[model samples]
Target: MTDLHAPAHPGASGTPVPAVPEQPGTAGTPGTPARDAVPAEKTGEPKRNRRRVRIDHLRHVVVEVREHAGYRTVVRHAAYTAGGARLLTRRAWDSRTTARHERMMRAAEAAGNEELVRQWEQRAYAYRFARHRRRVELLQMAINAPKAIGYATATGVGTLLILGFLITLGTGDTSDLLTPIEAVVDFVGWVSFLASVIWEPALYSLPLIALGAAWTVGRRQHTAPAWALPADAEDRDVVPDEGAIIKALSNLGIAPLNKAIKDGWQPRWVSPTTRSGPGWHTQLQLPMGVTVEMVNGKKKVLAHNLLRKPVEVWPTEPPKLPGTLDLWVADQGSLSGPTPPWPLLTEGTVDYFKGVPVAVSQRGEPIMGKLMAANWMVGGIMGSGKSSLVIALLLGAILDPLVDVEAYVMAYNVDYDPLKPRLRALVKGDEDEQIEAAVHALRRLRDEVTERGKLLEELGGDNTKLTRELAQKDPRMRPKVVVFDECHELFMHKEHGKEAAELAVKVMKKARKTGITLVWVTVSPTADSIPRDVTRNTSHRVAFAVGDHVANDGLLGSGKHKAGVTATTLIPGEDVGTAVTVGFTNKPFEVIRSHYVAREAEKGVDEVTPVVKRALKAYKVGDVWEVPETAAADVLTDVAAVLGDEPRMLTQEVLHRLAERNPSAYLEWGPTDLKAALEPYGAEQYKSGGKSMVSRTRIQEAILDRLAEADEDEGDPEI
Candidate 1:
């Protein structure tokens, strides 16, 4: 009784392969004709026999195991083995799990010595269509490039239509001598003939234009500038103009991005949320997309002459969360000089970019990103606005993720108190803690310098730059900065003073080019404050408001005195918080204005401070203070917090009420401590001493109940 029933396999002949046992249950007998067991029609037709199509006990169990682990990976391997077409797709690219499944299936096949080909075929059912879809998407980007040429024809045909309409308006004499209109029309016809002839010569030139365009695109790597809407910018239409283009271009500092925008290319606006706190901004995202290409005749896309670049307009600007800037920039203030008819610096990133417009070129090169670090340091100081000057320097160093750089703070008697809130020790908003942290940070930097020198010696390297160079050639090394703030404060302190001087000397004299740039900020140019050795070899010097000729002499010496800049004029008698910056190649200029970031913006506020405080403490306890590569930005943000303003943590009303009697006492309180003390109470806070306070939600409700007995009178936001 040859009742033949067996599993089908493409690998063997047109016969059912033998089925052997691998799992608990076994199916039809081996050597049976699998098709005969099912039906004759099903074996020849495309559709499989319905009975076989249905998963049996073994097939069903295999699927269940795969789902519990990872189904995608299993599917990927099945497809890889079944490849008559390109099998792996974008989704399947990460199918390591599927690959594992395939391996497992192979092992089972070899161990049992059973038919494996049929199982592989059954597992591939899900992926046949999915792989096709991804391939189509990849082809579209290139397919659309040729369509850009169509834009030129519309302009040309429209111009021709106008000319033809005008020609119809003229009346001409048909017989004998020509009338005036006839003569004019004849002249126009001849001009058209000439234009046609000239166009032939340019046909040759057209190819050259294409070659140039290709060359431009090839040399310029595709990096677009990040766009930011101002805090107050609304849904009002932003007319796409050269100015806006230039401003956009300025951000990249590398490519002419504005040109790309102007030439009608589409732009990609990323989510603007920072890497660390992506969830911070819950606001709706801006909707925008930009694309550009030149479509030739017949609506074919032209590669060289890109006709249209699309840009999608966003509904709203992305909100800048606190401590976000530190992630983008490297060190602050490189080319920080002033220029202009207004109080502007010659070049700092902030000073020059505060109000200037920017955009990408058709080729996407930025016009201004290069200007921030222009002439190195000597050129950026003068034009950089007072508040933005530091921002300018820092923006270049800190914002550039690709470059390896860091900044040191040597601030003394300066207005850079906005940086305290983010310092781990000062997060509680303690004033003394803020000061101690600053001092502690300086000491740490000095120690870092000593360690760096030793490390370099051990490696037979002299500087950080050289160390980085060698490390790149090898491995096992990191690029770091020993930063200093209010370094002039070093002169005031007794124990750390000499150490600060020694550190400054070591940095300026030997480590300047070793990737170390001394950021020496001071109120005076007095020779006594800054060492002559520092001034002599030091290539960059930034001068702010100071007193008398001594200040001027301490900087440019008597050389700048004849230039009409004196200490008295630099700082008016009563007013403070102003200064002048001198750089390498930039002329001395004034930095009069800059946007001061709110304290909360620099320091992590209520939304995340509690979490940060716990994390900072956890790092201390677990001895896991090392910065992760991905988390390095947060540590750098801590650096910016140290550079930013004092946290105005508490509400303004409470501080005002607390200080109503002894105004001086509240005024003198370090902004760091003042903010933390009032956080639970709730209040408006500011860096420049205009502190405020408000009652907490719970406390305010209680106060409302006792309003008749209360001493004060200002109401809450709603109440």
Candidate 2:
């Protein structure tokens, strides 16, 4: 018998006879042997030994094949281990595997490894063929086993029943065998009858049918376009689908949102709603450790993930709940337009001490702010409606019957001309006089703060703050609002910049308790323009479009932009009057659109002028009163007038006379106060015969020096 597992070589032959080798065509190349063949030299061994060797070799081959197949199976099953069993059921597995094979084949070819490339191509073909064969087998098995059995059973039962009927017809015998069949038929007939009886009520329920039809129609109507457009015109303004949005958000791998959905944290998605105007609204019930502020801080990233503009995607919280995120996505790229007109002021009626409506919120509700005990800082880029917002705030205070309005416009604009007449002090220009006037106003406000401080201390209850009761008792203590428009001009002045900034910081710190409100507006919101101390003390901040985060934080407080009250996303000309305001509403930060206050035709006055005039008439002693052109000039002359026929006078006596002349202006004057006020102008108090006194000569010299400087400023070619 031929040995199947023999070594193809002669054994123990001294002559060394050459054995016939297998043909290279059948065995492989000349250097290689057939995998299943053995050498012929070992054929002389015992049959039993040869048989044992062949069995052991076969067992080894089987083990190796099994091990290789097991490795492949483990590799294929890894997908299930990583992403769950759903991956195995999806057709994506086949496509992904095919793509991977193609990539590997291309890489192998690029590396010039022909053998590796061929091997990969063969493996890919084998895998695809095996997958197809297995799928076919499963499908055939599914089709043949239960379905064929069921069909055969059904056919047999029908034939038996038909045969029984025929047998009864032919034999005409009602026996026990037929009785069981008869009972079954009767049972089936009864079941059909009951089923029909149950269905009868459904046929007559017209109300339910009508209600369902109505609901379907209503749903269709609700989803229909609100306005008609020509065919073939793309409607880019359509709201995005909520399901698609949620899926996209999930794909972004946002930790809070994804973890909530995966870990059964009760993640609930709400249907998107429409805003009052042109925005889409949606809410998400945030998981633990997730807050609206957290989401808002990542607004730019979220916008990129959603493939939308940053300005179009706004994330906020419901006014009361921080855990519920309210996302507003504008249909238009910009959240501008449909701004309501400014409300008409009610003469002698509006009370602004508590709050006044300045703008409308995203939800169309009015946004109100309290001017009492509050200081405002408004900042934005040029043409960002900074002036309009300032006017809106001023209109609120100006319409109130008990408030005094003082505006200093350093960078003069025509917008303020209408309200000029009603202003107790209106200083507008970029000239030296204007700069000096603004500085003088700040100094006077500082003095007034000191006087009010003294009055509050005498009252003794919460002495730092002036209460409404005190204001009611003394009308002079009513709200005094000072607006500095284009205030950067004052801080940029070479001569007075440092002193002006210092005085502003002091006023912001000390004025809140004395019924004084400072509203400062600037186009350049920077550390150089707005001092840190002034920015920090101001409680109310409004920031429209700005250049960058630095400007945003300078206007709004430090780290406020990171906290998600960012105005940098706003576009200057596009967003117009839209702004992010803090301390205006119950929310930490709100996006507001101020109303447009149109300018009036008569007297170059705007809608705000008449309101301010009415407010001044109702509050001030006369129809109109002029403020001193310069506090320094007026103080010098007033002191000289009080010192008439006397070379020197006690500081106390001068303060007493000044207080009598203007009690509200000088109620807290003291020797130190007099010296500090006069020191800026090169005047000094001295000891004259055991009493501290001021010299008229020194006061006159200081006045002349200031006048000379003013004259030089007027003569300069730059002016």
Candidate 3:
């Protein structure tokens, strides 16, 4: 029995021999018969099993634990506690000493601001004096403690005794004196018993409370390191605070700025943080050797440090403050969001002399620029919102009936179809004929400028420029605005390019004072695309997104790129309708996001068609100032007619009513125009309920005065 399936053991020579099992088909051989053979597969053992699998499994478990959310949160909170303690200690130290004042004084001295240095020195001295006086008072109080306590105890005991005597008299009993003292002893004993009951629990909770407070401070201040913080922590839209701003500036890699910060340079806040429009605005005085230009150049880096996108942070120079940085930070994703609707879309009118609301500043304030007495050069690549901005300006113009808006779009699209009714002359298409028409329009504008100048001289006014009254009274002197979209086609045309450039230049130079505005727009901005003479004479320059610096400077101005006023920083598709504009603000340059007016029809809604219809109606009726001689009457009469039975009307409402009554005569009338009309009769607009109101009674009285004057003139003719 031990013979068949037994393994061979080591022999005397210590050599091992292998044992072989019976083959599958040879079950019943003579020497090896088939016993009940057990299969190796049924044993459930792997032939290649080794120790490496266990090691791998352990490593995977370790990784899972490390990656768990619960673990991360625990580590983050621990870090927060540590960081908060350090911050609180530093703050406590600064409060106890003159560290803040001393730091500001050093910064001021480095900036060569002696006045600020002296001011900080005075403040530090005052703080020291105040602190010293407080310390002396504390010392005196400590010295008088024991005597004061003794007096208080004696007085309290005597009062209690007197009360007890009073009580005894009332009770008329001998033992009543001890009753009050016994009650007092009971009260103290009860208080001690309560304290003993609460003491242990309170002691245990105090440390936890302290730890919770530390965590709160750290969480609010974002004190955890980046790795420990939540994955989306950096994406949070945190408003820029003083510490964040200082940290960003300090890390800008400017040697001088970094050095100054290391030497305790803190921002001298010219203005505290205040909500401006849709963002936060503050003015900071940079440390010495840190110019506004330097800060402007590092806008992307600064924005990143503040946990914001590059488009969300805007840094500019405060006028007349050389070292000052005017900073504004928008709410996260706000710039990418849709802007507010145009004010004129629902109800509003434009006064060409005052200005038109075209775009909004990065801070979300309305940006107004004068359309009269100015020339604009606008440039951007295709799909960069060049045409949209021009459309915004044109929309403002049509609201005023006196302004005749003419547009010649070379690369014709249906974007301008809604405005066709209001446009005086609309030329579309990029053909040679279209190019010639644009040039011809420029030629006519140039001639008109010359004729208007001569007319202004003939009027015999001391003022050389056209005035509102003069223009309103004489229809020929009315304001004219000409827009040339895709103007490069005309400016670079072989046949008419030279004449177009010359005529545009002439009109821009002379027509500013003559009440003509030229808006030159182009997708291609080059010396050949936009003539040098045109860019030279243009007063206002707006540059949208462009591919390179040369194109940016071509529209903004030469040397503008080097000066840190560049449009190249603008994102292409994401920043449509956003532009860098000069001559709009007093600063070197400003970024404006133009109000979006949908050009293509969307969901059967059209923004431009209705407005254009209104403009068309007003224009066809003609200027309100042009009343026929047979109907010749004073402005008082017109006001009375518009006022009807209403006792008082808002000045703006009156203007609208006047336009409605006689679009021919009052279509161009504005607040100033109405005021000027009323001034002659010693009648003026007044505010009622915080709104500009015109009284009907005042209009009636002014009419009577005009009638009386007319009678006088007729009756007193000399022989």
Residue by residue across 1-719, what tens digits does model 1's lDDT show? 22225442211111222333322122254333333343435345333333443333334344334334244344433333333122233225435224533543554343342444344434443334444566687688568756755766566556655555555555342331324345557888999999999999899898767555444432231122112122343221133222232233333322233334433444322222222111111111111231111110111111011121111111112123221111111011211222211111122111121112111111111112122212122211222223344443433333222122333343332223333222322122224444345555555555664565666666764433443344344322333322344444554455655655665555455543233444555554456666666566555444544445566657654445433333334324222223333443222422222222222454543222332233233233331233322221121122223223432224433333333222223322443455454344343233232223232433444334445435344543446
lDDT of 1 at 419: 30
**Of models 1 and 2, which has the larger lDDT?**
2
lDDT on C-alpha atoms for all candidate structures:
0.35, 0.68, 0.75
Candidate 3 lDDT: 0.75
Please write out the lDDT profile of model 3 over residues 16-42, one tens digit for every residue: 222333333323532432233233345
lDDT, residue 227, model 1: 21
Off by over 4 Å in 3: 1-237, 255-275, 282-297, 600-603, 621-719
In terms of TM-score, how similar is model 2 to the real structure? 0.51
Instruction: List runs of model 1 lying over 4 Å from the truth.
Output: 1-388, 391-447, 457-489, 492-500, 513-517, 563-580, 584-719
How many clashes (backbone N, Cα, C below 3 Å) per candidate?
142, 7, 4
- Model 2: per-residue lDDT, tens digit, 302-348? 67656676777777665444576667766655456657665544432
Clash-forming residue pairs, model 3: 623-664, 624-664, 624-665, 624-666
lDDT of 1 at 379: 13
